[model samples]
Target: METLRNWSSLCGYFVFIFLTTVSKDACFSEGSACEAPTSPECFTKNAIETVYNCEWSMNRTDGIVTFDLYFNSKTKFEVFNKTWHTIPEEKLIQRREVFIWVEAHVGNSSCSSPRRSVVLRDIVKYDAPQITSMSWSNSSLSLMWEAPEKHPALTEVWLRGDGHPAELRKETFTRINTDQVTVANLSQHSTHWVQIRQRSTQVKSPLWSNWSPWVKVPAELAHAPEVNVTTKRLNGTREVTLTWKLRSHAAAAAAGVTYQLSDTQSSLGCPCARTEKRRHYLF
Candidate 1:
């Protein structure tokens, strides 16, 4: 009876050891399967610099997991626990397709994300351009904006005329290769709202940037104002009074209009003008 009891106790100890080892191995295997990161996203913001920025998302797992970015046939970037990596311009050949993938490693476990293939030049997104100046000539409006880079670019312009809803009235898109663009046939006698957007022209496939802020362009004066003049003699000097009346049209007498009175003979005098140059502001 004593021998049987001892044999039973030894078998129980072995069973407990086997069960504990199996449980630990199973938990470790489960944790290793979760180390793979999500698929990566990669893009180049502009054609000028041509630097590729890549990122991936990963779930929280046990222990610290380091990442390695692999691209372009065995070229490896040691991300070192970072989710993002910037591939420099010097490491790539332009206008060619590149394959990219990321691998996560922790202790003896390793996993990889899904692979992605893309052309570096085809995935470009430029910064939004800004409108610098606006001018009017007859019935045309000229708009000038700052270029994000020295390279050529394609532009899209949106114009909204007065008395119309927020919808676009005119759309002008072209490969202007210049920062200045002129839109003809626009109404100079009516107000307008203008907005602009741009994309890289040097690339085969490029993305357009977000539209810039809307710019308010007041209506330009279409005709000269009607003036009434009265002359009076005081102290052997002639005093002249000039008064002008704007037309009844709302566009012709729009707010923020500046009326200037000037004389080529240098006869007008005011605090705002020099003695040699005669100029006066009539509001």
Candidate 2:
């Protein structure tokens, strides 16, 4: 049987599962969690610069392998040490993955301790992109929005509030960079609260953006549009031309204009109203 040997290392990042949760605890158990090297000790950790020394451990019965480390700490807490000694640490790291560096001597004569390094990285997290724009049809809504910026990968987006967690009953989208999207098969006259989360391609972990503002659809029957506005213009002598179509009337209203023109009405109406600025009016 080939025994475990030569496990390499990596580094760089904000500590994620390994540091904040796993690696930190692993290192702490060895550093100060225990009483002494020969006996046992539990390592303590801090927020920043809480790197841990590593070693290996093996199951006595089956020879399953593991590693450990130790640290010197000073504390009145009866659990922490004030020093950072690592000489007795060697007895700790015979079989485990280590993040902190310790010294190694070559021979018994005239030797300097060399530091060892462990390679570990933080897993990245991200949130889902929001739906910027949405429009409704009979039983569906046409959606459009900007894609999420700077994420490893988008895993899934879901429409919520319509069913249970398992019976979400909405189509799933995994596309990125396609701002304009379509969501079909919706009930009419009801609101849909959507929540989404993404994952990094590097590791199989989920990162979710904030939930978008809610959107509603008709859960029952629907109505059609009366008219779609396509153009508008202000003509001479209190005349406003409003042109819209998809129905019959393609021409302006017969009145040619409609208004109760007045300058003495109120000075407080609009102080910033603009007129005759390239066939445009602003107020």
Winner by TM-score: 1
lDDT of 2 by residue, 192-261 (tens): 6554444444432223444555443323212343433343444632333433222122111111111222
Best by lDDT: 1
Against the true structure, what is each candidate's TM-score?
A: 0.48, 0.33
The clash numbers for all candidates, in the given order, read 0, 48
Cα error, candidate 2, residue 29 (Å): 15
Badly placed stretches (over 4 Å) of model 2 are 1-122, 150-152, 160-167, 176-180, 200-206, 210-214, 217-224, 228-283
lDDT (CA) for every model shown? Answer: 0.68, 0.35
For every candidate structure, what is the RMSD over all alpha carbons to the true structure, in angstroms? Answer: 12.3, 20.2
Query: Model 1 segments beyond 4 Å from truth?
Result: 1-47, 53-87, 91-95, 100-116, 122-124, 149-152, 162-165, 175-177, 220-283
lDDT score, candidate 2: 0.35
Q: Compute the lDDT for candidate 1.
A: 0.68
User: Where does the lowest 10-residue lDDT sum fall in candidate 1?
Assistant: 18-27
